[model samples]
Target: MATQLDLQEQEQLDALKAFWKRYGNLVTWLLIAALAAYAGWNGWNYWQRDQALKASAMYDELDRAAAAGDADKTARIFGDLKDRYPGTAYAEQGGLAAAKVQFEKGQVDAAKASLTWVAANAAEDEYRTVARLRLAAVLAAAKQFDQALAELDAAKAAGFEALVADRRGDVLAAAGREAEARAAYEAAYKAMDDSVDYKRLIEAKLTALGAAPAPAAPAASGAAS
Candidate 1:
């Protein structure tokens, strides 16, 4: 019985050895691949965190420059942030913030350049839409009506159609296209929810264009019991 048990154990050991001989290299390679992937993931995460920290610091500096009303400094810091960490949210926010300062300081061309970069390169759709909308306003102010309209045409983000329509109306009105402007305003008014206070502003725009929406009819009075 002892001899029989030993023979069985030896057979089991031999079978394990044969399996290892056949699959050892494959198992080793799979383990190495998994470990390499895990390391790569950890490295990527660390890099992203490092980038965000640096970008946050730069954005704070940009904010200080903007607050001091130093458009040139704001633009310079924003440019550095964008160049070094374009993938960070700080870069996009800095672009928008820098453009606002530049525009307020009458640096229209610089503002336009910053907005154009954000419009073309912001990772978030909403940021891109905002950049395009602001760029259109700048273009319209410059009397570049066709380019303003083109920018509006490109501001097509989900949930922003109404705003795009409203801005289009403003651009058309600036361009002396009253009829088209009125139509765009009407579309914007119709798209807005009744509860939205912004709808009233759109309504005022429509009224200014001689296209005020009709007031809802009053509910019929009920007879007293």
Candidate 2:
């Protein structure tokens, strides 16, 4: 009986040896490849996480600089953020923030540069829209009416049609094209939400251009600024 059990064990061991001899190299390589892939995936995730944390910290610093109204500091931090992390959301936010701060601080050229980068490079359409809109504002303020109108004309982002029309009206008004200004204002009035109080501001713009304001009245959160 013992001899029979020994024979059975030896037979099983020989079968396993044969299987290993046939498939060992393939199995070993497959296991190695799988481990390498898993390690690479983990490494990639860690890199992404590290990038996000860095971007967040830089954005926080930018926000602080903005709160202090230090245009030079804001510009420098934003420049670094854009240079190193242009692919991050924080970089886009930094551009917008820099543009706003620079514009307010009377740095028109710098403001335009920041807005232009956002207009051209922003990953999101809405950010591009806002950048174009604000860039038009800056240009219009400088009385570069044609350029301002061109920017607005090129803006096709969803949900920004009203804003674009409104800005177009401003540009036309500045250019002394009252008729076109009125038409643009009317378009803006129609495109905007009737329940939105900002419509009233658009109406006022129309009225100023000798056109009646929108019939439905609502309040405003922000208007053109």
Which 10 consecutive positions of candidate 1 have the poorest summed lDDT?
Answer: 187-196
Best by lDDT: 1
Q: Over the full model, what C-alpha lDDT does candidate 2 score relative to the true structure? A: 0.91
The top-ranked prediction according to TM-score is 1
Residue 189, candidate 1: C-alpha displacement in angstroms: 0.4
Global lDDT scores for all candidate models: 0.95, 0.91
- lDDT by residue for model 1 (33-56), tens: 999999999999999999999999
- In candidate 1, position 143 carries an lDDT of 96
Query: How many backbone clashes are present in model 2?
Result: 2
Candidate 2: which stretches are off by over 4 Å? 1-33, 213-225
Residues 1-225 of candidate 2 have per-residue lDDT tens digits of 579889999999999999999999999999999999999999999988898799999999999999899999999999999999888888999999999999999999999999999989998998988999999999999999988988887788998999899899888988899999999989999999979999899988877767786365556668675
Ten residues in sequence with the least summed lDDT for candidate 2:
212-221
